[model samples]
Target: MNTTQLERIHSGKGFIAALDQSGGSTPKALQQYGIQEDRYSNADQMFEMVHEMRTRIIKSPAFDSEYILGAILFENTMDRTIDGQFTADYLWDKKGIVPFLKVDQGLAELDNGVQLMKPIPGLDELLKRAVERHIFGTKMRSVIKEANPAGIRQVVEQQFELGKQIAAMGLVPIIEPEVDIYSADKAASEKLLKDELIRQLASLDQDVKIMLKLSIPTETNFYSDLMQDPHVIRVVALSGGYSQAEANEKLAQHQGLIASFSRALSQGLTFQQSEDEFNTMLAKSIHDIYEASIQ
Candidate 1:
């Protein structure tokens, strides 16, 4: 493990930036950024366009480590360069931010009222490559749609199972098991998910601490116990499908949880904004999220 990065993450006073939109979600992300599908003809062009958006965000004046502890990258972005340095290196060396990689292949079809992650082939190889690039950790996601114990157990189990492998490689894993915010049984699902997580976390060895990324619970401080667990390094909240305003409002009620937002983080950004306008908007967003995180 990178002890410096580990300590920074354990004690950092900022939210994480989730910039890992993959192929399936790239169009929506680009569209929100004021780019349309017609602007790109193929996959390569599509990726190029999205990469440009990510690069612009990373290079912005407001994206420093002061209110942004880390940023998670897609595999392509991880392999790309920023201002003549690898993306991870640029984040750590130039901006004083830690870097993480999104490792899941994406969720599988909904099953048993949940959507577990698809198998991640070559994960070990990917972890090795991430280590070479100075990556501090990784993130994977699964989803819970209803209050089904069987399904939630499977999701949590899969996350921890893979988390151990990631830890064995000396990389901390942000195990994300997201509960759909719009589900009728959202609160119930959150409870079941939390129970399962505690059960699984208790079985781990003392040295194998991990991070968690979860949807902001319907009840304020619902995850407070998990935050106090010694096995958990930190508990971060995903914006899920909430708008930035709504997400930040919910996040503020939880003192220890911080944000790791995607759409929410890039909410008002557009491809055509002037640099000054872009920076101003970004600075506001970062400040709002940071305030809510530390509240």
Candidate 2:
């Protein structure tokens, strides 16, 4: 990332809008909202619908970029043109919304029942393309299902390795080690995650600043110190299938960890509403999340 782009992301407004759901996630999200899968048989068709949904929000009169520092983009939508302007250019030029690309392919099952994002071949080439497109950063994800120390360690190690590579490419990486919200050992898992993060950070170069997207904790202020680490540019929380209200409540407790939510951020929005109603609903949602974020 260029210095101006880095400053744009690390600025005091720390919220990130996670609209980067991949082909695997997009179809399901559309179905949940009553958009029939029969109507969109392929990924490109689904992306068109998804882009329409995102376009509505970004083009809304009440849309406020101040509530979000950046937006994470799906592979197809990253540079696709909408209204004769590239999506990234539209967001930045029109609303000052920084663009971040989601570089990970979908996840694959890993050892010990864990899941890791499929390793991208030629990721260096991809990051170069993102830079050429003027994208500011990248996000990659992995999932932790149990409190198994070994499994967590593997995830931490791999994520940091990849994060360091991203930093070397001059792009900030958002390392997302998402804990299962349904886990019986949520608190225990968080402790393991914290320990693993600290262990990994010790080995990372001090100048390689990165961001994190963690599952919101049930306990209040569990990651305060971790968020304050100098290597951690920003710490943001994922809703991890929680409802908007529940996510907001949990997010409020973590002082510096702001929202990078997907489902929670779009919870009340729908295709049935009029454009005016849609904008009003989204504006309210953004305001509520922003309030929780800055708390």
Candidate 3:
């Protein structure tokens, strides 16, 4: 990759906004506005509503790309047309925001109490589709709700293995291994995850580079060394059920780590708000997250 391209993928200047709620998470998001799943009747109907939400964001006065480096999209969002332009094209051409796709199928239970994404059966084909649509990268998630050495090791291996495949296809991968904030052993979980992550990355070829989307650490600056690693292109954080205020506080403590939050990024934003009110809240959230990101 060119030096400029590397910077575009790795720079610590901006944050990513995650809008890629799969089918499993979308209905709950709609329910927050009192729209029930039964009203949709079909998956396409549901997707249309999500597309409208995306349209609102793109058309908002505060939807500048300055604070937002990129937006992650569900597969449908990747293909859907917005104002006669494909969603990915619209984001890049109009907002200058890079587009990424969520490639993982939702999580599946592991015997050890962790969750891993279901197998993505046609990932290479999906990568070809992403390339055709001009998507810049992909994001997949695995969750560690408790501390288990065996489970953490599995998550690290799968994420890096998949990440290498993504990079080989000429797109960056954001390997998100999120630790649930509610866990009693959050600190120990982070340590185990980080140790496994370092081991996995060290095993890969030296030229390989990938991004990490982690939960905010219980220990301040716990991820500093990972952020500085040669193999880590960038380190981004998930809200992982944290409130916007708490997420910002934790994120601000770690340098070179930025936010790629979903719920926190959209907290207080809803269809019920007036356009002006919606814009104001969204802008403030972006500003606050941005400040934490670059601090």
Candidate 4:
């Protein structure tokens, strides 16, 4: 995949990871999120999904050409029953696009042995399958999470190694941190992650692309505030159903790398639901804060 185009689509327009309860293989379920119906159940769905995606590209009203539509294929999406839809090649076929497998997949790999972390049991075989058919641009990998504090240095380093192997095979890694710390001192929490991420990036071989996933700080700092430290590379936030205006305010403030999430469409006692004014309240405020960080 062209890192330039992938970077362009992700710079301001971001990706959303699915927290949906549906089993991952169901193409029809993917349809709810604007994915193609043929994208599930088997590999045969690629033709349909790619065709529809092109149509949407042609019909988009907003200047969305710079963005991409993502179907987050997390662990739930990895069921063999739905093998056709979630494989590495299905994603590689699309131009400048990313196939977002959930972060949990990588975390799970840290324990099973680092080799398990590659795209599939035999990613080479899969890519060989793609190459034989002249497939060249599909990038694959997962939204990432540092599962435990133990052995994290090894985990991060090895993951970088995994990314290198994948890149050799032609795929990009969407590095992310799971929102695991909630209710802690927000400032300290952010600092902990920010500091460590910088350290990890420093540990890497130069020229590797690392994307930092951060939540829209509703009760924290602004994007500019986070950018004060130069160690940061990319900033990602939620597009999870926030109002376009809410998302925009955040976007305007984002200064570096940026992406979106789907948390806004979710409902719970903690969700911010006041529509009183776009200037303040809940997801809007958080999104505004996050959008600014990504800029």
Model 2 agreement with the true structure over 123-205: per-residue lDDT tens digits: 99899988887788899999988888888888888889999999998889999999999988878888999999998888888
Error of 4 at 5 (Å): 1.9
- TM-score, cand. 4: 0.49
Q: Against the correct fold, how does model 1 do in TM-score?
A: 0.99
Best model per TM-score: 1
Q: Indicate which candidate wins on lDDT.
A: 1
Model 1: per-residue Cα lDDT at residue 231 = 81
Ranking by lDDT: 1, 3, 2, 4
lDDT of 1 at 208: 94
Cα lDDT of candidate 3 equals: 0.85
lDDT of each: 0.94, 0.83, 0.85, 0.40
* lDDT for position 295 in model 3: 87
Predicted candidate 4 versus true structure: per-residue lDDT over 1-295, tens digit per residue: 5555355534435443333223233343335434555435554464344333322322223212233334343333332212244332344343333444443223244441222233346656654544343232222222223333333344455555555654466544544443333324444444444555556666656555544455554343444444433433345565424554665564455455344443332222121223232123333433444444345
Q: Clash number for every model?
A: 0, 1, 0, 24
Clashing pairs in 3: none
Give the winner by lDDT: 2 or 4. 2
* Candidate 2 overall lDDT versus native: 0.83
Per-residue alpha-carbon lDDT of model 1 for 64-103, expressed as tens digits?
Answer: 8999999999999999999899999999999999999999
